[model samples]
Target: MPTIHLRRRLVELDAQILEQKRVLLDLQQTRIAVERELRETATYPILTLPVEVTIEIFHRLPLEVGDKMGIRRNTAPISLTAVCRIWRGIALSTPTLWSTMNISFDDIPSTVIAKPGLVESFINQWLGRSGECPLSLTFSLPQLEINSLYDQVDFSIRRLRPIIRQYAHRVRYIELDFKEDTRISELELHSSPFPLLQVANVCCDFHIETRVFSNAPLLHSLHLGGEEGVIVTRFHLPWQQLTTFEGFIDNLDLFIVAPNLIDVKCYWSGRESTLGVITHSRITSFTIIRDCDILQYLTFPSLQHLDVYPLVTYDFFESFLKRSCPPLISLGADAAGQGFAQWHKALVHVAATLENIKISYVPHEVMTSLLSLEERPWLSPPWRTLNLLPNLKTLHLSPVYGPVDQFYELVRFLYARSDKLRSFQLEWFTTPFLDAWIGAGAPGAHEKADTITGHFSRLQTAGMDIYVGTPNRNYAAKTHDAADV
Candidate 1:
């Protein structure tokens, strides 16, 4: 009914109205989606992050404070799942977060040794979450002598044995500190090949049938921490496969059997028996936490590190060095009543290759000689132009005895070796004189004291790593305090 131009204009106006409606519908849908996201953020903030990012943040916390005992339930990996449904999904999906567990039960903590099915359930649940990850399990079984207690332990072991057998192949490291009991055999079920087992620490005097693990291609470290000095022959270990051995054993005959053993650490002290001298070519590291002349009967040509509570007699040590010219890189020894001059006789043999020295008790002569203004003959043997401990880079002196005079000598000794020394830790700098002076306010020598301290400061400023006077490191105090003389 309108004019032609007006009619055409009206149709165009209708098309514009339809296009605007489509745009309005799209805007309303976008507003709903944005409001939904805002609600989610307000309700569960952590879930806003990708599930993978939240799981990674949880992994940084210590895994040791765990579900093995009820005491740590609040902090264990399982506790994370209980906090919220969001975290529960994240944790169960992470295998490595639950791969390690430390289970300790004995007569010591009453609450730790729980009922029959409880412990088995705890272990089963903890390990089942590990998926296919290698496990590191530290289990300390009950060391009970009471007949009643043994019954409880037997039941627990029987129930847990199947769980252990199922997961034994996944175990990479396991520590068994169990004493001999009826349940000990049940615990020793590595009778099945632990295909992934690499380290085993066993504390038992009973004949350990480790022969079962001999076929385990990856098992290489064995530690026996029994007190009875269990004879090596009694342990049917996979000696040929082992590269590291620790614990107490006086019998040196094991050296003959362990051709591949490269690291040996043990304690020895008793009647020094005259045994046939045995030599090993592959051992590169050896340590004795207790004093012994165990070195008298054994030798290692490939030895690179020697640490001992006491190297014992100089004659014995010198003789041992003469027989086996090891390429020693580190030396730690305590002078067991041996004089500095005598100890030096044996020490010079390894000076050529020694790069680290940790002397427990710095000999009186050595301390005095270290402070000498001139180079002493003791430090410079005529045999070679280089000084003693030529290549020494790290030195740890447990305690320097006598008075502040010996304490002052430390700076001089360190300066003497400044060319090569980069790290130094003097455990204790206290002496009777320094203690007395410090008690009296140290009036006259305050400036001198500062200067002496300044020497250590100067060394530190020169980029050398130096530390002195650590708390409670006073090994100079006599143990038991029996000798009041």
Candidate 2:
């Protein structure tokens, strides 16, 4: 119906419009994909954090986390590298992430037994990634049973010795775990002074020759434990400057060598003999395990914290306290081999300065007797005394087996210190019974829970922090606990 040129122009315009529509559809699809990706990327905080902030986040991870990753090499620095290009750059530059290298021969796969060079290369690469940061190394080799594997073990040790020698100057902490039958002579590193070393936690099967650690000027903390026991005569630790020592020693006189020690935790069994008197001025904390008769001979003038189990005797502890007369701030009186009532008298000696007290595993009958209104009505409660730890802030006790009246006694005790008391915690020795009680909707469980919660609320309102729940085993173990201390 139209002229020829007009018809041709109309067809060309239609094709141009169709082509533009195709291009518009492509743009719409691309915009939708970009918006979806933007939403996902926005959800991740790491994406928005600066590189420095991200690096610090990784630094705040526990040192033990790296120790755990020693068993699985692919999870840590390696796994972190796989996240993204930016993260990979940040992780590689952060030397602290690689500074703590946990190397256990147990982690070596049997598949790599023949390839000792591979093991050597791996260690070199791992430590090399740390750049120049101070190292915390934990090297452990399992006790070998098969005599035929000695050559292979020697090969790995030979490879490792060179690396240790290279980095010994930078090592801040070195924990060595080896068996007694281990061929100590093969390593040829018995005399090396760790100039920068600060802590050594070593477990050995044989005598650790004093020459093995010639002089550690900076070394302050040492934890030595093993099955054959540590031979103190053969160990020449820098005792004069030592601040913390934890071990089981055959010779009890080793305490005399460390005058500047701040903390001492040991296992001693000198039952019949009285070791001569020893005095330390700087010691602030002491934790003694089984059979500590040596406490009779030692005096710590500055002790603030004391944790002892089955304390030699009430008389022995009182005598030790009198001799040391430390400015007592914290006392763990769990398993004192006596009742709370007897220990209460001992506390009076330091009550003027004591601030925090933890009591656990008290005999049920004794606890009941201590709290009974009728039994010791004459003796005023500890709270009312003017000279007895008026500034006391925290009282942590394990669950006591007694009546509701006995429980209320403790509440009253905290109430008396409500003005100054900051925290009052009742920790469970075992799993919390409240969990199961609340789950099953037991008849009296709600009432019991409400009563505890109400006390917590009142304490909070009165300017105290209250925690009534299961005990954190890690925190208890570090500070003090009945079973562990």
Candidate 3:
């Protein structure tokens, strides 16, 4: 072997090494381009968005916590973090997305991070991300056997007190739905006051002697859902500060005490034959359902909306009207006590201001009287003299079976008020037609029924929010023409 031959071999090897390095560089550049393209196109469209855009998108998700429906574990913000590193960063950074929570203690250890011992830490972490935003919290307990509920609810409350106290000042809305008939020994709240609490809904048959929610200065709305046994006075607070009161009220003291109260949704059905009268100047809306007889003792000067469902006494109802002399905007009542004629007479007091009328159930007498009313809902003196409700906006009727044939009369009645009308709901409008449609041996019955339904549809379009069907059906799409319905 010669020295010159060895030199030639070394040069060839060096050339081969240079070519391999060039190929390696080409492969590295190709890999970089492929990775970039894959991130842009192959990744989820949502994930590929700008971080801010992704955060905004995540905020729109309906994140309901402590749901037995599995929405939390599947679609919660936590789940977003589990998707990938990019989403995890995005979700963790968004504070408003974790500010609101609707928690139920029904399915224990299946909500949030979903373990027996982790819920507390999970909740702390969930809310910790909310930053300085106000919190909206709802804590509910499922119905269970008394023995079983005691230990479970006790444990939950023990765990919850500290968390609630931590965010008490930040609470804007808080609803505590405890198990039925839980004798709660009110804990000594040696913690911060709820200065930002605007709404507090406490639904429990409490046996506590101490007053709750007394420290909340900004509370405006309070819903106390206690049964007959739970005395209303037990959980007393600044009643005068509340503008809206719903659910239970044992006596008429609410009207007497709550001077600032504007909206009163009373579920009182006390059958006391007599009670003293009380006046509330600020009550604008009053809706009561199920056998109510409390109207006799109350009067409102500035009443705008009144909804009552009862076989009301004519004397009391008329007395209520004469005493209040309110500028009523809406009225929901049944033709009871002295029947339709008397009901109409009572309505004369506020007919000038009444725009919305809801009749509970129409019989032959009620239907006939309703048909007789001259086209208007107000007192238009030059327009034919007898105007019971001249400027009518909405008319809701739940007709009985016998008055099914009176649909045409209803049509005529609504046709006059169509100018100012917004809504006209006729529930069970197909009840009478069902017999005919189901073959009462009548020829062309089904076609006739179809035509009737079609007519109702056409009539619905005439009004801004007209619907003729059962309670659960959507007969018409509501147009915000007149007022909120």
Candidate 4:
């Protein structure tokens, strides 16, 4: 009878324990429901808006580094998705947000680069999320330090070729940077045209022999750089469609390739390069560095803006103006310790149309000579000619050495062109004279400041905006408008 009573008690206790455990679980579930409801209430503000509006807002956010869909974390798209279930749905569905990608091998892990198949898989996933949107892709090849990993890089390129070819039709902008001798044969391997490609920036240390981009009809802007620089490549680009080109050209004559270019920024290395006997009629703007007598060789009739640094000779420009007769409206030049003779001649030709003049580092002697009152019978024809820059409106001088003490001459120059001079700015306009005048901490510092202020006060009576920066660490000076009292 006692054994039977114990067994019954034990069974009852087991049943009671199971009942308590079930009740505790029910309470815990209720707490979770309440917590979730509170969270939804807190996010009600953003959740209240339409999903479309939120997607648009997300698109306007700044682009973040890393491939969140790949190995990278905390990317803009990833963060947006992590916010809430609603946000995650919207972000994953928005195709435009995933349209631009930089697939660079420069800083990626060696393990990933070695496994070309893995890279292709990640890229495939990323592009799949983009949902057929036009892509802007930048591929940066590894530098020389990874030369030993040639086999890995080759494998990686081979893997990426098929993936890139699949998406080539949808790519609008493409940039490639190659630092090593690893030839990018993939560009040539694909025969299909890059139908939508508009802009291309190619930087390679070696000459690319393949005419890979010859069929890209819509391509327009091209920026080429590297040590060996650009030579006629096997890849024939549609040069006729190119309106803007910036790069180092091995050959001076551009008419063969890019004749219709409207804007050209070129670095001509060959000192004697006369851009072959070709005339570029549509070129309106030119920025040349390390230029020689190339200007004399080329004719630019439609040019409106000219910026040159360190001309080979004044005669080169003079002859160019005589030949081209460009209606130049704006001109910028670096004298590079040269005399003002060349400038005077160039100004005489463009004075009728030139409105803006920005000269960097003109010698003090040149400034003094311009402001000098002495008459020189043997001076250049332009110097003898009064109102040299009759139509000049803005004059900006950026002197390499500070405190260009040509203030008096500069003011006089302004007065000469007071009829048309609207603004005059001097960068690094400091002076040891002013410091000495102030005596640093001398007793007459206030008086010195007043004296310099008075000099400028008189100049302000003229009708031009004058801006000068004091010799200080911070360039925080304001313009002293001459028109204002």
- Which structure among the candidates has the greatest TM-score? 2
User: Local error of candidate 4 at 309, Å?
Assistant: 2.8
lDDT of 3 by residue, 1-485 (tens): 89999999999999999999999999999999999888866866766668778777787766545344222332377768887887787777878777877766665543333455566676777789989899988777646765653444333555677788888989999887776655333333334488999998887665566466668889999887766533456656778899998887666667766799999787784755344777788889998755456777888889999887764566767778789999998888875434344576677788788888888766666666566555343643323322656667887777643545655555545545556777877766453442112101112222222233444444455545666656677444433232211
Residue range with the least summed lDDT across 10 consecutive positions in model 3: 434-443
Residue 256 of model 3 has an lDDT of 62
- Off-target runs (Cα >4 Å) in candidate 3 are 1-36, 39-43, 48-52, 63-75, 110-118, 146-156, 181-185, 189-191, 269-275, 334-342, 375-386, 429-465, 469-485
- The lDDT for every candidate, in the order shown, is 0.67, 0.65, 0.67, 0.67
Weakest 10 consecutive residues, lDDT, candidate 1?
A: 434-443
lDDT of 4 by residue, 1-485 (tens): 79999999999999999999999999999999998887787747778788788887887777555652232322567678887888888888888877877766655656666653677777777678888888888777746464464544333454657776888899898888776566666555347678899998887644656555666788899887765446744445677789999888767545567777998988876645544546788999998877655676688889899988765578877777777888999988877734344467666666678888887876665555555522343666776543555677887766645346654444345445556767776666454243212111112222223334333443456445666554353221333432232
* Pairwise lDDT winner, candidates 1 and 2: 1
Q: Where does candidate 1 stray beyond 4 Å?
A: 1-50, 63-75, 107-116, 144-156, 188-190, 207-211, 269-275, 336-341, 363-366, 377-386, 406-410, 429-450, 470-485
List pairs with backbone clashes in candidate 2.
190-212
The TM-score measured for candidate 1 stands at 0.75
Stretches of candidate 2 above 4 Å error? Answer: 1-45, 61-75, 144-158, 183-190, 206-208, 269-274, 336-341, 369-387, 402-404, 427-456, 467-485
Clashes of each: 0, 1, 7, 5
Residue 303's lDDT in candidate 4? 88
True-structure RMSD, every candidate: 11.1, 8.3, 8.1, 7.8
TM per candidate: 0.75, 0.76, 0.75, 0.76
**In lDDT terms, how accurate is model 1?**
0.67
Which residue pairs in candidate 3 collide?
A: 376-389, 376-390, 377-389, 377-390, 377-391, 378-389, 378-390
